[model samples]
Target: MGRSGSCLCEAITYQIPESSLMEAVCHCKNCQKQAGSAFSTLAGIKKSDFSLTGKPKLFVDKATDSGASVERYFCENCGSPIYSALPSQPDVIYLKTGTLDDTSDFNPSIHVWAATKQNWVEIDSNMPQLQKQS
Candidate 1:
């Protein structure tokens, strides 16, 4: 069976195929500001694995490193970020893990953009941390 997730208000829903790649936690400034938290947790899944149930507002932001644009989709009603897609990497969509019904089941295998990680936040020491997305 596929994994499912939805926005805080359940206004937007999506699914990821069972074989999708592992989850990741991003400490990039864009992610932090967007999530209003220390980091953003994302599950990488092929575009084919995802489907939207409701209309979401899209905010396109340019990545500092690649200068590529990333389209972030969220529910306008609740301001909950549902997913993000990179224009340069069209095949994958990063689903916001916090929107998942079973968020406890999500484990981040890697933490990226850690150079900007907040000093108050402590991450798992065993997990790999890279300066940028790897």
Candidate 2:
């Protein structure tokens, strides 16, 4: 079975197969700015396994802590973020899990960019954390 999700306005919708490649929480400053929050919940999905409807506007973010460009996609209608893609990882897209219809199962296995995490955010001691993107 596949999972389904949509943008806030339902203008952009997407579907992914049974499971994702990985799930993580990104605490990078750029991610926080784009998400307008403390962190971004992401699910790594293969491009071939994902399907989408509607067009999303893309913003090429060049100012990243990793020194790599990130392609941020969002709904033009409601301005809801859809996903992000990295040039180095052409086959993978980091889906914004918040857009998922069912996010109850989003268990982030790791936290990236912990060095820049918000001062008020506390992470589990057992969950793997990276000071920077690994």
By lDDT, who's the top model here? 2
Q: Candidate 2, residues 1-134: lDDT per residue as tens digits?
A: 88999999998999988688999999999999989999999999999998999999999999998899999999989988899999899999999999999998888999999999999999999999999984
TM-score, cand. 1 vs. native: 0.91
| lDDT scores of the candidates, listed in order | 0.85, 0.94
TM-score of each: 0.91, 0.98
What value does the lDDT take at residue 31 in candidate 2? 90
Q: Taking the candidates one at a time, how many backbone clashes does each contain?
A: 0, 0
Off by over 4 Å in 2: none
Instruction: Tell me which residue pairs clash in candidate 2.
Output: none
Task: Candidate 1: count the clashes.
Answer: 0
